[model samples]
Target chain A: AAFLVAPLQAADPLPSWNDGTTKQSIVDFVNKVTEEGSGDFVPVAERIAVFDNDGTLWSENPLPFQVIFAAAEIKRLLPEHPEWNDNAAVQAFIKSDVAALTANHNKGLLEVLALTHAGMSTDAYDQRVKDWLATAEHPRWKKPYSQCVYQPMIELLEYLRANDFQTWIVSGGGLSFMRVLSEQTYGIPPQQVIGSHGQATFEMKDGVPTLTKTLETVFVDDKAGKPAGIYQFIGRRPIAAFGNSDGDQAMLEYTTIDNPRPSFGMIIHHTDAEREYAYDAKPKSSGKLITALEAAPTHGWTVVDMKKDWETVLAE
Target chain B: AAFLVAPLQAADPLPSWNDGTTKQSIVDFVNKVTEEGSGDFVPVAERIAVFDNDGTLWSENPLPFQVIFAAAEIKRLLPEHPEWNDNAAVQAFIKSDVAALTANHNKGLLEVLALTHAGMSTDAYDQRVKDWLATAEHPRWKKPYSQCVYQPMIELLEYLRANDFQTWIVSGGGLSFMRVLSEQTYGIPPQQVIGSHGQATFEMKDGVPTLTKTLETVFVDDKAGKPAGIYQFIGRRPIAAFGNSDGDQAMLEYTTIDNPRPSFGMIIHHTDAEREYAYDAKPKSSGKLITALEAAPTHGWTVVDMKKDWETVLAE
Candidate 1:
């Protein structure tokens, strides 16, 4: 007599995702585009998936992490620079006056950025960001900010990579800032991260080459600029786009609309206040999801409700 | 029963390269950087190698291929617009008067490019380039322009790739034009090709997303700008750089000068007058190697003698 046993089933690629329509949709889309002989199959070279960094991949409740870092940098550097104390905008920022900080079309924000982000060598700036992330902890969780990345999204990134897709981070954050953490937190390398960029001058300083950041006109990578950035950097239209805010609306449209390949668009709806912060139209900083949320249904985008779709919040 | 057999020495990775110091240097550098226990070993992610496209990778004798394409386009589009007939620059270009076309800092050249390069959707421009390449032949070789690419360089690209190094093209050619042939000719993807970039606007035309190329301030990827382009696009500093002219001096410097990891720099001296063209200090178009050639020895940059080192010129 012989006993028959079924071969072990393949392990779940997205263990953090709940076994529901949302999870099934992601799996189905990957299978449709990746499996050989499928009608919707896309070649591996064209299999690009772009994700917005701030709210989609990580928590951005009170402020985007970069902004928080900037604020912290201001405090840390204030003692050495007494000239900043005379500026009213700097005083308002020090007092935590949100309205004052945002007033005058963010003149104060620009000033703060010029102070913290520019006037240093890029290597020095990279070191500063790395050091801050190593020490800085989220106020609410009391854990490193890098540890607050979404578990489901991280798994999704890995799953797409496993299927021979190139995962890219298209963010509104500073290119230098996002690149420092992206490879460690999301497995996305620096070359694959596209973000808002400013002018950097290259020169040889004392026989050593150096790149210094400058307070030049920054190319903002939000809203319609996202699509422009994509065209300039990637040189190919992505097959899938994921975002959680209005800033990413153009990118989503650019990804899915009239794409020759079968494409996908997903919106991460922060509906779980218990597990994570919830906001859509009115966010404390950065994300505002009204336009993208309203357009999602018409575009056939899957709206992922955090409460219903994700088994876990932060990456383990 | 065992028959004594020698393991077939792995097929020559760079077979088009002659058995000489130049070829051996490349193989030795790759081995030193890729071997597991070597002190100079670099991680695969950090092993970036950049190459110049025009003279370094292919034959840029009378003019760079893109300039030739532009000249062809001027003639092709001239009949459509009578106003262009009134323009002196257009007439000079049509007559192939090099001195007149280059007068006033290549004012005629710029005029030709504006008419041929801008005022179309990027998609339309891409299709036009593809159509031109498919039909156009090099006047010297009487073959498709793509076939003029150097065989030794192609093999070098493959050899580096086999060693897990990412090869990138940082050229002075138009970004979109270089991207069309880069993948098929060099086995490099569009994302890895960085070049001169013009502003493109994203908009919806007839409910279809479109990117219209504009005659704006183009960021030239030449001379000092090469390193800037690499910084903006690739983020990480390259470990190896290859070029054929003075325009690439900054990039060569940025790549090898005090790089954290072991680095290599090579300049291809155009000396094969019979097989290709031989002009360094006084080239007919684009590439001019004087300052870089003088500086190479002090920098320890290997200068390649094209006639002696390359067993084959054009890709077979």
Candidate 2:
């Protein structure tokens, strides 16, 4: 028993996490599900954990990273495509007017995405995203967008993987957009990243097969759509869910409520304006953490205060 | 070097496959990719192999197993819901009239699916499929549908998996239907099985979160749709693809043609009329292999003549 317990005690899987109730809760839940012969022990094959991307795993302050990427892409391509100059939505995007860009239910944002994301081979689109990620730096962090990921969240991901849990990203971000950086940034492979996707048409072009992305809208993986996406994509229920906004409310409910196996849910409360941008109830962009934050106590979900619970915010 | 060579010579990964050019080609491909310091050596993470279900992995002669399961479900539920009796499609299905069942481009079969597959919680649908698999037997084999898998194919699945290749099932079968048996029969997990799927609506029913299956076509993973489904589900292109009919032509092309790395394509020809139902130019149900079979020669894809290449057909 001493030999068995010593290794777990010595190794701090969540080194970035402060020695507080939040860290203990994660460890306790993992131990309960992984301990052999325990009443709550889940089989290795059933240990699925899902995470939301934008504000939960990384910073989403001024705007969601993909929106910024889309805007920059339009700017980069404007010289070649002069027709876009006359479009109001394109103009709104270029002017950095968030109100106009997101008004009328993200009409401008969708237009920006169509110009940048559609009518290209999937491979070509992937390269464009990768190039943007490599070159683009967060305005405030002064780090590459990929490096804006939370150090504490990265530790948790690794810890869960160490316990043989299959981690997946269920986000509202574009599927192709997240896939380019998923493996390198989060250790989650492309297949494990489920998000909003556009219709793709398969064709043999110039003696080579190609899947061209189209502007046709598919399911958006957020809120209630998260659970539906999980069913269609993951095929089974996840026992653990994590998020930072109201967009993940249905996902958390799906993971924890009435689950046959013991489940865990956690909310990442952006409470440290000094270390990270703090916004809730009225955020700057994208993430609105009102309903989920209110429901956290009733559902017995862990509310992680980033200012107090994290010893480190971002990687050095 | 002698000790290392001894195990390689001693083990036969494909015992059910006869020692011939077909088997040799498979071994050669595996060796080329797995050997270290070789030009064709692909990293383990990039080695993804996709397989078609039905005629490729198991028997689909009298009908696709899913169609048969749907018919059986209709009969089982007919007594409780007498309203189904007045329906012509339901009557044709119950009477075992294939002509009427598949007439008007499978209009009747679609009705059968609506009655059996939709209007239930996804969890309940999964249970129904499992129960049907448990009770239903192959008409000729007299074995459970789950046990009707091909022995040689199963061995091939194991061999690829042993070599650090991630195996996935990209089939035209229902997603929820195949997921119930994929892991148990093929050792492929639920998330790894990509197939035709129905739209599901997520809601809280009596305070319990549920995703109910809806009679809406989300996607049909067949023909050109195969490559599209792969783009949406798997993200990256697979290094290898396996299938038996024309439905997989697009998938095979997507896997092998112009891939930057060494790739493989194989077709399982149902030439053994005695052991398995043989149909290529025309199949009774879904699989029709004319174009793909003719194209195989041009593409240099291995064509496995089932009667000549396989030493074993179904599991004993």
Q: For residues A24-138, what per-residue lDDT tens digits would candidate 1 score against the true structure?
A: 9999999999889988999999999999999899999667888788888988988998998898777776776767878898888888888889989999999999999999999
Specify the CAPRI tier of model 2: medium
Q: What is the TM-score of chain A alone in each candidate?
A: 0.96, 0.96
Residue-by-residue lDDT tens digits, candidate 2, B7-108:
777578899999899999999999999999999999998999999999999888788999899889988988898898799999998888889988898899
DockQ of each: 0.68, 0.77
Clashing pairs in 2: none
Whole-model lDDT per candidate: 0.89, 0.92
Model 1: runs farther than 4 Å from truth? Answer: A1-7, B1-7
Give stretches of model 2 more than 4 Å off.
A1-9, B1-9
Enumerate residue pairs that collide in model 1.
none
Model 1 agreement with the true structure over B1-316: per-residue lDDT tens digits = 1333435457788989999899988988999999998899999999999999999998886778887888788888878989988999889878877788788998998888888899999998998899889999998899989999999999999999999999999998899898888888899999999999786778767867788887675878898789888988889999999999999999999999989899999999999899999988988877899999999999989999999999999986
Q: Residues A3-91, candidate 2, lDDT per residue (tens digit)?
A: 88887775788999999899999999999999999999999999999999999999887889998898889889999988987999989
The best candidate in terms of DockQ: 2
